[model samples]
Target chain A: MSEFSVELRDVVKKFPTPEGGEVFAVNHVTMQIKNGEFFSMLGPSGCGKTTSLRTIAGFEWPTSGEIYIEGEPMGHRPPYLRPVNTVFQSYALFPHMSVAENVAFGLEMEKTPKQEIKRRVGEALEMVKLTGMERRNPTQLSGGQRQRVALARSLVKRPKVLLLDEPLGALDLKLRKEMQLELKALQQEVGITFVYVTHDQEEALTMSDRIAVMDGGVVLQVGKPVEIYERPNCRFVADFIGETNFLDGEVRAIDGDRVTVYIPRLKDELVGTKASPVRIGEQVVVSLRPEKTRIIENKAKMGNCFSGKVLNIAYIGSDTRVFVDLGGVSLKVWEQNKISTLDPEAYYERGEQVWVVVMPENALVLHLG
Target chain B: MNPHRRSPLVVVSTALVYFFLYMPIVVLFLFAFNSSKTNILFEGFITQVGPTEIVSGNVIQSPCGPFHWFCELAKNVEVRNATRNTLTIALISTLTSTIIGTFAAIALQRYKFKLRTFSEVSLYIPIVIPEIVMGIGILVLFSQLFTLLNSALSLIGDSQLTLGLTTVIVSHIAFSVPFVALVVRARLHGFDQSIEEAAMDLGANELVTFWRVTLPTIMPGVLSGALLAFTLSLDDFVITFFTTGPGASTLPIYVYGLLRRIVTPQVNALSAVWILIIFVAVFLTQRLQSRQAY
Candidate 1:
């Protein structure tokens, strides 16, 4: 448990093309997954997230470099020999086998005694909350039931690492949301290293202890979910992990820890933290969260404030999204809902002028380019 | 679709075609127990009701003896020999073709490498070429081999591939392999490769996965193809005609000889029996294969 569950060093995988030449699926990816940590690889489709997972699962071998599990070098071993089990996205449950049979397959292969196999199978079913449904065929179950069976099948093995490749991607939105929390709880309860992969950002953000945001065969950032969301290092990370408005401006003044920047259209001096050290007049991108911006009816205590036209106002359930057109740039502001809107609080309609303000500390200057 | 509308077009058309196709066979089947000494049964110009127990639309009973028909059929030695020969050849050829054809299908379908497509195309070549051409090819090859070796040994006749059990079996296998390969390969193309991979991932080796997972999935296709190949081999005439010798006479050959002479009731009875067996075999196969695409 103290060792790294899985370690890949400079791993490279290439696939041959029909017309000729090789396409590098994973180009020199070096990642280390810690024991008992839930790590997720997130990216768009065909971006090599699946390829990387398959490579680690031993179904596909890395064209170059070494992979180790629990400090033991595992070199191109077949899937059966690897101390890992994968719950595939499609659930991949045996259609002909009943639930108990599918869950007991690995134990049967290990030639466990029949009584022990039955007992363990029963326990595994209970762990997945599928105890009473053991005799049902996989075809008779719903999508979520099949997924639970798949999880049971993999979990009962007690592998060093459980590789789950988009296991909840097929379910409906409601089911997917429910399963996200279930999976997180399950991982915590079992205390096993879960290598999960999904393209959904919210699912990864909510479920993973640490998230690896990947795109185009490269991992851009890896950190705790909150850290990655709050302190995104670059434009790609900022845009991928959460909603962020880019305030394109040049640094006017540079000093210790803080700098004053002039937004051209807003005509306001915006103060932001120096994430990357830059020259006094160098151009930098400020990633400002919409939720951080406030609507100032009169005047408010803030670092930077400016007047704008309230171009649009959308009423979400718990909050209202207001789009303020400050000159040429339209900034977004999220206002919390209140029941005491009897006076309507001098509601601003389209083409109405208003003031949008933000605190310097909350406005993040994250990237240079 | 409507009760008021009166159109028996489909039923009338089908009945006409059915009678046209099966009238002779049905007549022959009926006469097998018709108590007639000869094959021809309705041998009267007009028996104009001196023995009248007939209504306008009633069936007229034929005046024939029952003992002669049954006893004569039972006592026919040629009929007995031909029936035995037919059954033995059909069963043996079917069994041989199935074994060889299944092996051929597996080899040709599973692998891809140098000259594999060419080899597959060559297998199909035997199917497309005229049967007489194939028969002639077999005859020439056997004759040349026998002449070369027999002359050297001062022998008169008899070679390994000459018209006997071995030659018939070999010829059937050659003709049937391609059909089996065609059917099995088509089924294999749609087979899910992941199931095999999953079996392997669960600690089964390649051989174990193939035998347990892959083979069972494609078994129905192989069996269906084997049934087709068996029927083809049993009914084969042209190729068997050239390859078979006197001792290796098959059912078709025996029937052909019987037909060349006088048309005996024994021949009709034998034809009815063979037809019944074919119908039953086809019916059972269809029952097993109901609605399955393969």
Candidate 2:
């Protein structure tokens, strides 16, 4: 009924605290997830990301405001009446049922014909790469296999949207990563809108078409992974998305799209592009990603460059993380190790003098509040 | 410590504990076949060799009639009546309590309402409060209610109400519900609420979700609770004694009456059979529960 697959309009969900005070779990959260887009709500625990997803799944009814799915208002409708299915974080595969039976449950609930249910269940199991395991009970399956059964169970319904609440969270690290790609590929193949909820930033960034970074029952930023990571709108979004070196400063001057930030720690005026309109007297934080800043043996000819002593050098397989102390403040910089040699001479030594060079276009001017 | 080698102290203590637990039941089973009417001691190791009876000592007059005792018990009218009454009350009460208590447990576990905590705590009252107090309370309640009913009936005709098997069953159900509820509640504690949600989200209604998902998940606990209720009802004497009328005596009450009259080996035979039934039921319940735990 709506252009967007799902929309929440100023939804606020209040939960009673143990002390009897009411706290908003989802406070005035407004967002529209497009049709067939992989939209993720990413945040730390207790930040209302799961609540927002649950609201969309119709598991939670907002205390105030309204929710719409496919242009239709969901007014006190139970989850059974809603046209969406969820793969729960715990897998939630029916332990008593076989994989095929679990997958066919939604179809059976809809009163689908016996032939169609069987055909569709078979197809669904095939889609999840679990064709031969149909007769096996969920309890006999491994964590990843159970997760796939849950996926197949929900996906067989062919609902308007599929909700995944940290479906890969229980798996081991390698399996989680593998499933992350498989889930993205499966979503694209099915062409159904997905509302994925997770606190893992890398997971959100790796698969989502767009991400909504939530904190304190609020949606702080909603944008593509690149836009959210590179040009975060506020301090929390910038820091939470990835490893960012925050330079607290005052806005000294604004020239066109370029703004000069006066940092007392570096005793230097760093120039970067502003994400929003800023006044000269406003306090700003320059969000510089660790990977964006390069450690140079010599001073660069262009951009913001500062000389500092290397505080720590850590070799983390793929890259070398160098922390440099620039007078009063230290900046973390990640440099990819391009060479394959293990020679000691190739690595940067601690306490070595180096220049921290940040590209002006790479630095983002974020609002203090 | 090596896995195979247990310390002597541990082995001795374990053996002592087993002896303390099972010695009485073993003695009861042994004396069920006693040749004499009294069951205090064995009658000089009397032995039966096929048709001809062989005796080790001349002090005994008859052989230990193991099969004869069971045969006499089966023929005894009171024992048969008690057995029938015990089984009937146990089955009816177990069914009633399991159904009512499962619903109560689900409502308490899944929903929040006014007086919810009070209701939850009230369930424990029947379980933890001494059975003697419960028996007296039920007896007083029934007598007062019976008097009130009879007075109302006096308008039409004069009739007196008397406690019977129905009263016994009702009282058994009253105590059985709490034990059932406690067990089902423990099962529900580990139940993943999301599985129910997933069922509903998959378009199954609440009733269907309960039958398809919730019931099957907690079936082991419900069965075990029912078995426990059945055994409790079968072995119950306190409440049954207080509530039962003259002709409605259950097996335990009948056994108590027999013991007061005389310590016949027939009573031991009945007890041995009762103990066997209870052991089988309890063993089956434990097996069912342990299977579900995995």
Candidate 3:
């Protein structure tokens, strides 16, 4: 059992649709989660991130391909034999069971002695900081407390891995953030591999050791949280992970990792780092994050810059989102609160000429389609 | 007219229509304690005033008899045996049908297969078909087998074939399985499937998941369905009438036989008792259903 926590080799899951054909829920996807590592599958709804998690939990069986947990091939081995548990999105605590009973259930299944079961249940409850809630049913607990009970239930088993599918998604924003930190700390303290699934980009970014950005039943990229944010490999990944200004283009030149592409929308040539191979004259897409794109009052010659009219602008307290209309398309620039207040009226007005500047290296270009 | 007012004629008509719907049941229930011999008030056309007696707990005897409820019912050995038979058949049918049909419900809920829809539809066939037809069909089939091969068939021939307590129970079970299946099915549908999955993830095999999680959660449904099946079996006359050969008779069938001989005041008393028993049964069933909404 001492092996990588999980390994999925080309797993594909399809669900039967009512009108005849099946929907390819989880397309051919291969991923590995190291032992004791915190990994997350990040995506939009219906993107198969949750399905992948379910397959690992044995709630779903792949149409083809294999799933291995701790080096044992899971060939229709019902969930019970796989030393893994899931904290469901709804916190799926047994509504009829008290918090302590829920936590003690796994131990009781193991036929552990009563004294040890009670002691470990107490320990598990305390681990989640939910002491004295042993007898309270799930309804009596707040959303966060219920989530803790779910965590405690699985954690008491000390499974090889803990799979949490959107565990914090049901909580309010403040509670969600607090639980995110708690989950990370808990994972560290327990030292068990955790495979978390969530559609919240910021949640994945803040909590995961490694994040797999998925779209349309495919994993677009997988890397450390910072790597996914700072160097998104594709347009979908860039758009899904954070705010980005997309520009359609054709590859004008390719020289190793540095490529020059002409963006037809802005009628300009911009330099960007290439993540994948691209042929010359191929229709490609370039993504510049809103924060990376600078707005200057005067023309800047050192970086890629274009002058355009500010079609609209919105002040969001902490940042100003300025929409600069460049004829065929518009680009967004998030000016920090301090920088935005420096010239408030000049940007928020309509039809005001503005300079949209982008650092050459900060722009990310890729062949997403 | 004020706002939200209906016409005066419409209100009067509605009240008259409601009275028509309830007038008979109200009459029967009120006169269950009527102190007069006549089904209605005494033929003298006098409406008695009882600000005292039954309505207030004074010692006035009921109309049908001396509130002789227990001995009134126990005087006839035939009625007593019929009561015993009815209770026996209902209990047996409810227990057997609930166990078998709940397993069937579990299969339908847990697995996916071709021809599942066909099997599901077939489960309701017994319920939709005429009960009288089903009972008579079984009776005819069994009687022919018993006559043609009296010595050859032995397992059920001893008692079930002779149309006594055994035949009644078997017939009841046949008519009840489908209703049990349907209610258990709806309960299974509304069930949160994750309970089974959770059990498995916590180191339970298929059998364990079923025993530990699925069965306990679905118990209320099975129980309520069993009670319904029992009540239906108790009230069934047409089906029991056809299936019973010479000896087997349920309470309703016994009442029918009594009506043929004489509509004894005791029969009315028995009818009131039967209605009272079923009333409690229905009340408890409804309570069970409401408590299981979650």
Candidate 4:
């Protein structure tokens, strides 16, 4: 058995457009998912995240390149021949089958003994905490219950990799948050590789061990959740993962890993860690997260800091987002409300003069090709 | 005005529409037990009879009795044979058409090929084309096909084939296939294809997936299609008329023959019986299709 549970080698999937031209559903993309790792392919809709998951599940064959599961290359293998199962976004549980029967479907297909199938099905349901819902039909179950049944049905097979294409996309917000943690725990409990595809970045960050953020049929960046959020490699990854401010600037000087960029809007030179290679005089974008920047009344600071006026302040539950306008550039700064009070006068008012302070390490320089 | 409030104009119009729709069927059902053999008038009533035979103008006639036409209908040998033929054709044709149409529907709905659009559009041809035209077309095609087969076989032996009950059944199947395909296709339209993929993803092959997942989910559509096809074949008159040779008369054909030659209460009774049977079958099929919708 290979250390990597699944490996996609430069896989590309194309579909014929109505005009007889081919468009790439999944561009040249490659990633290795470790054994028992919860890997997420996170992107917006039509970004080929689902297509990549389907490729690994053998539902869609790549137009080119290879897929290897546990070191064996899958060549023209059908979905049934592969050792993988998918929990569909719609929870595609068979409406006619009971919850127990749906969970036992895969075992029955393998010609397992009837008693063995029953035991495994029972165990699978218990794993998802759906023990007593055996006799209920999928249609009769609530959305969350049906989602669990889907998970139980797929997990019952105990495949090498479990592919989930936005399994929580159908549930409401409260249930979705609950299921996200449950899914992570379940994946760890089963110790099987989970390849999850979703457009919800928060959901991906909350659940995945590592995430491959994709866009326009290409994998932009792949890293741990913190790495993807804090040190995004490109502009797309930085903006897509979380709320960030992009300030267009030109590279001024380079000092090993640190680079100085001149922002015309701020009329100041800021120094930060260079995320990608850049040359002097090359135009780039400095991505700074709203939560990373501090709001200080005094402009005097050791690191990169700017003086600006408070453009607007939004009171969101626990955090207050302040938009500070530094000349032509507007920077969003989030300050957490540690003191629990619903006093509007206590927070920063609009049009107030506030100093925005961003450390050099927090500002990431992103290069565009 | 609130749209939810009932309008008198709408209610009256809907009532008039139903009246126009069902008035003929109601009259035919009521006239089935009209007591008189002659169906032109309602005049052969025994107004003052004493629970026995009636004498009127030196002519003796049997008194009015309940279910008079139905009893006569059950005893008529021609009508009995026609009913038997109708049931036989309907059952065989419904089975054959439903199976074929289900496969056709799955193929049309699920797969993509060069002529997929062409095939999808063509399914509507049989459903939309005039029934008379379709009947005549099938008659010509079957005749030519049988002639070609018989001539080829006769050279080896003297065996020949003729249009009869088999031909009627074939004709019924030909028309019902598209209808069954339509119903099954409609059901498949809302079907989530991921379940089939899920089945396959769970290590079930295509055949197993179809049997365990796909077919069961679409069973309501298949059953409703079969019921509708059965009713269609049973009530068929024009197609059977064109396709049948001799001794293969279905109920509708027999009823048509009775109506053309003689206007009797027996024809009305037979029509009423056919209508009732068709009504029940159609109502059940509609209920099935509506259930499948949710």
Candidate 5:
């Protein structure tokens, strides 16, 4: 078998608009998911994440390209012929069937022995923590239980690759968080390649081993969660993945890996690392995370320190988010509340003059799409 | 006045509406047991038989006690034949129309083709047009087609084709198909297409997925549609009147003919039996549907 469990080679999917114009739902996208890897495609709605997952699952055929599952080329193969199953966002359980029956349906399709089907279905339900819900209908279960049933139904098939289209999207916040961790654990236990699609960046980051951030039918970056968050290659990825402050600038000087950008608003130069090569004099945006920037009293020791007035301070439990205005550009700085104190004077006050310092490595110079 | 309590006027109006709707049926059922042959007067219940009496120059007897008219209705060969014809036509038309209409609904709802819009819009035509017009149209079409076929067949031999139970059943199916299709289509509207995808993803092919997932999911709608078709066939009068041939008279046509000749308590007995059958059928269906609800 190939090292990659699933691969899409320049897959393009086009759908016709009601007005007779064609729109590319997935545009020239290529991705390789490694074996037993938890891979997630993260994007906003209509960003082709779900479309890419569907193509990999063989629910849809690419207009021009090919998909390979476990080294086998899938060309116009229907979903039933592919050894992949999907956990739909709606959980798409067979409402008429009981939980055990729903999980056994795949085995029955494979013509497995009845005893084996029953044992496998029981094990699958137990894996999803729904062992006792065997005889209950899908409509009788809660949303999260129904989601688990959907997971068991798909996982029971022992597919080479499992595609999840926002399986936890319908759950409440706490349940979604719990399921995210549970799904990551389940993927590890089953040793099946998981191709998850979600619009929620936090969920994707928490569950996926590697994430592909996409926008407008294109993948902007694919990397580990830390790499994606720390060194985003484009403005969309930086903005989409997490909260980041964008500083508009033009490239001034280029080093081997470091680049200097001149911000017209601040009338100062900011140095940051560049992942993709940037030409001198090219316009780019520097993405700086709020948590990476520090609010300090001493500015003499800092290299990229700017004295600014605090515009707003929001005291969230673990961190204090302070918005600092450096001339016309407003930057957010997150200060960790390490010391437990309820005193009002312990926190930075609004309109107070403070120095915001960002390390050179923390600022990411991204190409303006 | 209490906000939850209904006003006196509301209660009276509701009672009046129900009374208006069921009064005639109730009277007909009550008259089924009446001993009077004329049925214009409320004769006392004469369960005990005395000596044979002559009323209005005709001999009247209550051989079957209070169920005299029902027994007479059961004995009438013409009514029995009509009842058999009605049931056969209804059952056949219901089954055929249900299968055809379900296919039509699925095709219209799930597939896109060149004439999809036209087919969908035309499904409502049969339902919207007057039944009498449909009856007349079917009659004319059948007459013309049978004439053409008979003349062609005469060239070879003396084989012939004429309207009978076949024609009645065909007409019933024609009108019933649209209602069934519409009802089934309404059920299909709320169905999630992703369930079918899920089934296929689980290694079932198109046929298996349809049989296992799609059919079971939409079965309630199909059953309700079938029930509607069956009742429509059973209750149809205008279309049956025009489409039927000799010796193929249904219950409603037979009742109409009986009314034309003379009104008897046997008609009331037949109607009372019909009301009971319909009520039982509706009750059973309702119970089945509730039990099937998840």
Candidate 6:
């Protein structure tokens, strides 16, 4: 068996527009998903995340290049012949069938023995914590319960690679969060490679072992969740993944992986780490996370310190988000609310003069585009 | 001025509309048991007398008590043949049109081709065209085609081509297909396509997915369409008149013939029975649909 559970090598999918020209839904892209890994394709709507997942599932054949499942070429293979099952975003449960029948559908299609199908379906429903819902129709179940049924239906097939297209997207926030943890745990227990697609970054971050961030039919970066959030390789990735304050500047100096960017508005040089190569005098943007910067009383030991006035303060229970103005540039700093206090004066006040400190490692230097 | 409180004019108008719609049917049903043979007057109820008797200088007797006209209708050889023909035509046309129309609806709704829009728009043509015009058109087309086939094969006597049950069934199917397609297409409009994808993802091939998932999901629509087709074929008059030949008369045509001859309560009895059958069929289908609606 191949080490990789699924691989997409230079896959491209084009769809014709109403104006008769074609648009690339999935541009030339490649990905290798290892066995038993929880890999996520994360992007906004129309960024080719779901399209990429569809290609791997054999619902769509690539316009060019190839897809391989377990080292076997899947050229023009129909979805039924492919050893992959998808949990649709809509939780496409069969309304006509009972829960057990829905979960047993795959086994029945394989013409498995009736006794075996019953046992497997029971076990699958048990895994989803819906063991007693065998007689309930899909329409009678709640949205979250239906989502679990969809999961159980696909998992009962025991596919080599399971494709999930925003399986928890229709659920409430609390349910979605719970399902995310449950799905991660289930993947670990089953030892099956999971290719999850979602536009929700936090869901992807909390569940995926590795995430491929995509935008405009292109994958911007692929890495662990921490690496994607902390050291995004481009402006889109840095802006899309989390809350980041961007400062447009020109590269001033390069020292190994560290680079100095001169911001015209601040009239100061901000030193940060660069993931991609940049030369001196090249235009770049520095991405500084809100939580990475701190409001310090003194700027003595700070590497990149700026004297600014607090423009606004939003107290969101756990953290106080402070928007600061340093000269003509605006920056955001998040301060943890460690002390439990009812005093209104404990947080930063508007128009209060504060010094913001951004550590060199916390700042990310990325290409301007 | 409250929205829920209807005005006097609205209530009267609604009552008038229903009265106008159902008064004729109620009259026809009541007349089914009229003791007068001429059906010009209601002498008395058929069940008032157990045996033939003269009362107040009027001879009163019911051939079959309260079911006099119904028994007459059942015993008439021509009406029996007409009923058989109607049912055979209705059943055959309904089944054929349902299968063909479902295929058309699926193709139009699910697939994209060069002529897809044209094909979809054409389905509405048969529905919008007048029934009389469709009847005439089918009649002319069949006559011309039969002429050509007869000359080509040189058929004679029993081998000769002519309009009969086959022609009536074909014409019914032609008109019924569009209604079935439209109804089924309406159902398909709200369908989520990913359900089929889920079935395929579960290792079901296209045929299996359709049988196990797609057909059952859209079955209510198909059944309702088939019911509409069956009713259309059963009661059709204009097309059946133009297409029916010797020994192929249906119930409606037979009733029209009876109206020209001696008017009898048997006609009322047939119509009353027809209405009852339709009501029972509709009620049973509604019950079945509600039971499946979980």
The candidate that achieves the highest DockQ relative to the unseen native structure = 5
**Consecutive 10-residue window with the lowest summed lDDT within model 4 chain A:** A297-306
Question: Model 2 lDDT vs. the true structure?
Answer: 0.88
Docking class of 3: medium
Candidate 5 lDDT over residue span A105-217, tens digit each: 99999999999999999999999999788999888899999999999999999999999999988999999999988999889999999999999999988988999999989
- In model 6 chain A, the worst 10-residue window by lDDT is A295-304
Per-residue CA lDDT of model 1 for B1-294, tens digit only, reads: 788775789779989999999998888777664333345554422223233233442213323333233344567776666556656766676666666666667677666667988888897898799999999998787779766777777765444334566676677777877787777777677566666666666666678767766776677777778788878877888888887776777778777886787665556666676789889998888877664332
Q: Going through the candidates in order, what fraction of the true interface contacts does each contain?
A: 0.29, 0.91, 0.64, 0.96, 0.93, 0.96
Ranking of predictions according to TM-score: 5, 6, 2, 4, 3, 1
Candidate 3's displacement at residue B281, Å, is 3.3
Ranked candidates (DockQ, high to low) = 5, 6, 2, 4, 3, 1
Badly placed stretches (over 4 Å) of model 5 are A343-345, B49-60, B155-158
Clashing pairs in 2: A1-A70, A1-A71, A2-A70, A2-A71
What CA RMSD would you report for each candidate? 5.8, 3.3, 5.0, 3.5, 1.7, 2.1
Write down the lDDT of every candidate, Cα atoms only: 0.77, 0.88, 0.82, 0.87, 0.90, 0.91
Provide the lDDT at B283 for model 2: 89
Q: Which stretches in model 3 have alpha-carbon errors above 4 Å?
A: A1-3, A16-23, A339-348, B1-69, B109-111, B151-160, B285-293
TM-score of chain B of 5: 0.95
TM-score of chain A of 2: 0.97
Model 6: native contacts recovered, as a fraction: 0.96
Candidate 5 residue B96 Cα shift, in angstroms, is 0.9
Interface RMSD of 1: 2.8
Supply the TM-score for candidate 5.
0.97
The per-model DockQ list reads: 0.32, 0.76, 0.54, 0.73, 0.88, 0.85
Q: Which stretches of candidate 4 lie over 4 Å from their true place?
A: A301-303, A338-349, B1-23, B42-72, B145-158, B279-294
The DockQ-based CAPRI class assigned to model 5 is high
Q: Give candidate 3's total backbone clashes.
A: 2
Could you give the TM-score of chain B for each candidate, in order? Answer: 0.77, 0.90, 0.79, 0.88, 0.95, 0.94
The complex in candidate 5 yields a DockQ of 0.88
Clashing pairs for model 5 are: none
Q: Give the per-residue lDDT of model 1 (tens digit) for A190-231.
A: 999999999899999999988887777777778999978887
Off by over 4 Å in 6: A342-346, B1-11, B47-59
Provide the global lDDT of candidate 4 against the true structure.
0.87
